[model samples]
Target: MDINAYSARLHRDLYAAGQLGGEDALVLAEKMANALDPSIRLVLLDAMVEAAGEITEGLAPGAVEVRLAGREVQFAVTPPAVAEPIQPGTAAPAVQPPAATGSEESEADGGTARLSLRLPERLKGRVEEAAGAAGLSVNAWLVRSIAQVLEAPTVQPPPAAPSTPSPTVKIVTGQHITGWVR
Candidate 1:
């Protein structure tokens, strides 16, 4: 197995996801060089799977497409879904969602949901920048941020109300020879 090739692909995946950058690629390389903990290694493996989702996010949303190394590929991101409306007098038979393909299922087997978001090139670059500043892998950073958001409630502006003046308490302390209050 080509370790460099593996790293390169991981770099591309993270780069596309607005997570990792050129610099992060080097840090990950260094980590791989030293003895890595099994748990941490598992996390890196998940990050790689998540990176694949990131690459998909960068693709155009029409029919599936592939690009050659020396060619430019054009595409869009519209995922097709069957959402037939229920008839007025009759009910439609319940249908189950199809099982995920082997490759897609493999990611879930590894414990990461592998979600993705399509972002413009400039925006993706900014994500990489932010990830670099935080010294985290692109997938790691994005996943952490997403988990935090999911765990926290959305912020709402405070409601406006009738103006009620707050009560003020007065404090009197006299250690010196001077004490005055108005």
Candidate 2:
């Protein structure tokens, strides 16, 4: 995308708005616009990066990344991999997969986002206890657990006929022998 165009448009708008203040404002506006050009472009790039993050989340296990060249913005998308579904009552592997080098590098350089989650009272207590046991904050523990799941193997059941029962997958959420059904 042509980021320069957007930067130019914003400069034009700001300069036009400054016209209300007369000749002195016009001169200052031109100077200010030139000074703010880089900042405006930075803001635009940040917004585009944020949009890419949202898209990536929606496509979990897939990714959409935005990169900035000298005067343009580029987007790279990695499509999700197709995998056979796991049968109901079966669990995904407990072993943690090797590090996702790409994700690790990006995550290390990125900032964190807020997530407001509402869990059942029982579940919340269990999560808190587990986090305590692991010597990490609840948020940290949750983040680690979610990361493990995403990095683990994917499991999706085949589609079922309308007249038949939908296939459900069972997952173990914690230490206990629990059946998290879907």
Candidate 3:
């Protein structure tokens, strides 16, 4: 298929899916114009339009059906059952992925700093006890502690003052030092 033709179709689909406005369509067109390959651009546009349709339609059900290329794409904006709407004078619950807490690095050998700290025996024992009470392993407890420390920045030490000269200095005569006394 001709990439230009496909790109135009994708743009139309996005508009019909109620996922993009005229300005957004123009922005997408600009991006497609700058793309390296027309086919890749068309594919990306299609994916984006489809994903946007899913998300927006899910959020605002029965809003409208978008018309594109003599066809209409119908979408509903129904939210998840557990997603409760915020009432007046109330804060909306934050929408974050529940499973995105720790180290979601792509590669196995991801560059993460590992610090080995040797605290006093008493402190170590306390940490162990706390970890046991919280039903977490030692490693987990250490990770939590490190995270807390990172969240609260360290108090930097005050800068040192320049050293001053001593009032007097005594010179002891020795075999190795006897050569030069200016």
Best by TM-score: 2
- Which 10-residue window in model 2 sums to the lowest lDDT? 97-106
Q: How do the residues 1-182 of candidate 3 rate in per-residue lDDT, one tens digit apiece?
A: 23465556665655554444577766665565445345656455566555754443334321222223422233323232255678999987778642211232212336334456898999989997985664444544565566667768788979986466455555667644322323
Candidate 3 deviant stretches above 4 angstroms: 1-110, 153-182
lDDT of 3 at 86: 83
Q: Is candidate 2 or candidate 3 better by TM-score?
A: 2
Segments in model 2 whose C-alpha atoms lie over 4 Å from true places: 83-182
Q: Deviation in angstroms for 119 in model 2?
A: 39
Q: How much is 174 displaced in model 3, in angstroms?
A: 61
User: Candidate 2 — what's its lDDT?
Assistant: 0.71
Clashes of each: 7, 1, 7
Q: Candidate 1 — what's its lDDT? A: 0.49
Better of 1 and 2 by TM-score: 2
lDDT of 2 at 103: 39
Candidate 2 Cα RMSD (Å):
19.3
Model 1 misplacement above 4 A: 1-110, 157-182
Candidate 2 residue pairs that clash = 85-156
* Per-residue accuracy of model 2 over 19-86 as CA lDDT, tens digit each: 98998998899899999998998898889878976776556455666877778899877555545687
Cα-based TM-score, every candidate: 0.28, 0.47, 0.25
Ranking by lDDT: 2, 3, 1
